[model samples]
Target: MREYIESQLARGRGYFTKEEALAELGLSAEAFQAAIGRVKRKGLLVSPRRGFYLILRPEDRQLGAPDPSRWIDPLMKHLGLDYRISLLRAAAFHGSSHQAAMIFQVIAPKQLPKIAVGRQRVDFLFQTSATFEEANNPAWLSKLKTEAGFAQIAGLELTLLDICRYFHKAAGINGAAQAVHDLGKNANPRILAKAASAYENSAVRRLGYFLERFGHNRQAESLKDFAKKAKSFKALDPAVKPLVAELGLLDEKNPDWMLIINVPVELEA
Candidate 1:
């Protein structure tokens, strides 16, 4: 019964699955179909996905009305990304309140799976291990990093270094800028040094070169300096040297937030 569904949901986190319905309502196959059909048509429950449902109340979706956009969060939990809406997705979430929620930005390690939840695409990025300093700065970044598997929260400086390093791969330069400019001090250096020590490649050096440009007297600055001293990619890894050499370094100070490294224009910019 509707009263039973409400009573059952009232006790927990406001979500119920088909199995939950089976246990509570004891509906046979046809009865279950009719009950679900009635609730959904009345706009009292929303089907987030195939079997999972959320009690929409009067706030968002009407009861029983399935909103495909609501599928990403639960999907993320199922995949163990422990993801949050961050980066471009966060910006979009902030920027367009009325827009359809298709794309979700999240922060999880590289080990997580990539998924296209309905129309929204969920992506993943790898974060390096962080020291004590990087973890507590950006309220959002810190909280995001602490989400289950992606717990190595980097400081603002370390995050900036990472953004610059993976600007092209993770969120691109704009995402990198958003990661850095939104937060103030967490962009420290000592955290980045540890990252640099592990991220030995041309991509990292190019990012390090740019980040070293914006760096203050932080620990990552020293690490960036060391990364710049890598001379050529050949001295580092034999495999990535050629790719590193292709993306040249830029020393000119331009707030353009551009990637000076040369890649084909058709590449994901």
Candidate 2:
């Protein structure tokens, strides 16, 4: 079993499924399970998902498995799921490295529990297939090369919008603001406006507020027309409880973007 796994690795394949192993080894189900179990016990293989196994090279043993970026493409293909690297993970790739990404973040059509294997962790954020397809414009996605292969990642504009849309998961409003501050330098105003059109108006408003607060006025201006059209005001940080409900005081509102500043945002120099 070890030799077979090694040969597969040699052939440039990093992973295999249980069915493939059973067939290739010509073993009964019970026997194959026992054989694979032994390899796993020896730290030669790690399974991030059921029925799938990743062979660990000597260099990869320290990390317990290959970096998620190295195999995410093939793994997503194996599971028959469409995905793109997104949120904080995608922001880091775009040079918004203010906050280190603690886990790999992915956007997929279906919801999934987090996957943790050794030191590697991956979190999945959900979107409907229709919504994901509509937002996954070719111009907003890019192929990023990794040690094992290439993985699809959100482009600058998409990354910024996704971070705001999922701000709670991306480390709240301040975290989202930090990413905006870092990424704002290279943001293309025209492309950002086009991308914002695909997301909810609230997220567009939050993003615009962050951009203006972080001194990216031009980029903020690009999103102004779209944000101003929002039917209602949205909290700058959706996670914060409304001050109106707590203290019976109206929250400071940014009329330009129509956002209720429910939380304070602090940015680093």
Candidate with the greatest lDDT versus the true structure: 2
Clashes of each: 17, 0
Q: lDDT tens digits, residues 11-37, model 2?
A: 888888888888888999898889988
lDDT of each: 0.46, 0.85
What lDDT score goes with residue 52 in model 2?
A: 88
Candidate 1 Cα lDDT to native: 0.46
lDDT of 1 by residue, 20-95 (tens): 6788788887888788889877766655456766565564442232232344445445444443344344433334
TM-score for all models, in order of appearance = 0.52, 0.93
lDDT of 1 at 206: 46
